[model samples]
Target: MPRRRPNGVGLEVSALGLGCMGMSQTYGVPDDRESIATIHRALERGCFFFDTAESYGPFVNEELLGRALRGRREEAVIATKFGWEYEGTRRGALNSKPEHIRRVVDECLGRLKTDRIDVLYQHRVDLEVPIEEVAGAVGELIQAGKVLHFGLSEAGAGTIARAHEVCPVALLQTEYSLWERHIEQEILPAIRERGIGLVAYSPLGRGFLTSTALPAEEYPESDYRRHDPRFQGDNFTANTAAASVVREVAARREVTPAQIALAWLLHRGEDIVPIPGTKRRVTLEENLAAVDVVLDAEDLRRLDEALPPEAVAGTRYPEAVMHMNGR
Candidate 1:
């Protein structure tokens, strides 16, 4: 795996990183053994960047990654987030207060089984706690040697600018797959102006761009896809048809649709790094190999036109989840 510098400060990571959320929750049952093996395989393949959040599995995901990186922690760059409040094991409302941010990083350090976090994200913008305060809190942590870099997830453009003013944002984690292009208009340009790298989550459109995607109803009630707007009703049918362009392009290149989807993002810019999540080693290998699947001008054009922002139906998230994006 090749490395790319997402920021001018020389933060280099694998071209394609592994997203560790699915290993603990959302997509399916927890597979601790396999998830650990997948994480090891990623490191073995030279992909050392792994993404997880404090809210994921309400805290178990960080613990799981901690266990996986136990002896080999020196070879990985771990990125975890905070912002959501937790009462015991249950997650509560968004709370990015300065105190909350410091407390979460301390707790996350123990759960992650590491002394310092490679990258710390806000998880989601907290409207109540000003962005400057959040950034300042993270800045203090960075100065104290608890955090190496600062990032924001799903934050608005103005908020990003304001936060960066307080503390330089090294990366912005957001959903920016083919099906999710809402950030291109304002967010991308704003971050690019500041030279903040993009850490694209859901680079596979939550599996819709892949061949294994099933209807929303097909997923278990506990799965997040069950409530995703793009996976429901007529939107599923329409989105499926729109995603066919990926299959067509994959067929032409003799590569998997997932690879095509990831390759497209790679071609978008060197500043963009897509962290596609998977608990299985086989799937992990397939996603990492996307770095080698080159997309030409024609391929890029066809993909962009096939899935325009308007062509895809339904909001990226359900109404309740969309409420958090206001920041």
Candidate 2:
């Protein structure tokens, strides 16, 4: 039930948002009934910041979210993104051209069943189209009253600066967790200086920080983690070992490791809002509980020492996907 304001954007949301990606794709099979139920439970718990994207399930995820929010729209803040060129679930090249951005926003509005998007982000920077143009396109949408705020995902500092100059970016969604701290080097400072809030995705190391995570090989081929380097081979072992610190702290605090991991993010700054994805009510409740798990200075120091930026084992993404991060 805790609330956070992203970089003084004047937009407040639940400290922990619901990441609606895995409910429709990537992690495993789709479970619409449960996904909707989880979203409802999130609302009941006062966790009203829900994140989705046009690329998630290529389109179905937004539809599912729309269905979930049908009668309760005003109670939740919806955040979704656009960037990838996808048809159904078959993804193609990245496209953020002015025309494309306009097209995508219209479709997203339809799928979301909403007139205004609480926050609309460019999923990934489109090198083909200048960042300024991307920002301008979103600015136009804002003027049209289609988008309430603008955001960028996995964008480098330079890109963020350029875009914000054209139009103030309310938030920056990127991969940030105990294992992935690359943003701290430059991106984080830049966004903070610009008063841009951060939305931390994969805050639990994509479930690696949780006890339920299995070796890469144990995941089904359809699971994205099966191909993620951090979850594969020796890297998985090393990362799992690194995450033991989370377990130790959780045991001492009498909290779940997931809570420990999420609380660590919450401790970083109020400017940060983490959207941990889940398709079940149980996991959603557990993640929401992180808002209450306070990490004092000593606990913060121990966690930082335990999983220092360099300590994490593999790159956060594979080579091909890594290239698209705009960092």
The lDDT values for all models are: 0.93, 0.92
Model 1 weakest lDDT span, ten residues long = 318-327
Off by over 4 Å in 1: none
Q: Per-residue lDDT tens digits of candidate 2, residues 1-327? A: 988898766889999999999998879898999999999999999999999999888888999999999999999999999998876678899899999999999999999999999999999888899999999999999999999999999998999999999999999999999889989989999999999999999988889888898888999999999999899999989888888989999998999999998999998898999999999999999999888998888888888998898998888888877898855
> lDDT for model 1, on a 0 to 1 scale?
0.93
lDDT digits (tens) for residues 1-327 of candidate 1: 999998866788999999999988899899999999999999999999999999889799999999999999889999999988888988889899998898999999999999999999999888898899999999999999999999999999999999999999999999989899988889999999999999999999999899999889999999989999999999999999999999999999999999999999999899999999999999999999999998888998999899887777889888977889837
What stretches of model 2 exceed 4 Å from their correct place?
Answer: none
TM-score of structure candidate 1 = 0.99
Using Cα atoms with residue i matched to residue i, what is each candidate's TM-score against the true structure?
0.99, 0.98
For every candidate in turn, the CA RMSD to the true structure comes to 0.8, 0.9
Residue 290 error, candidate 2, Å: 0.9
Best by lDDT: 1
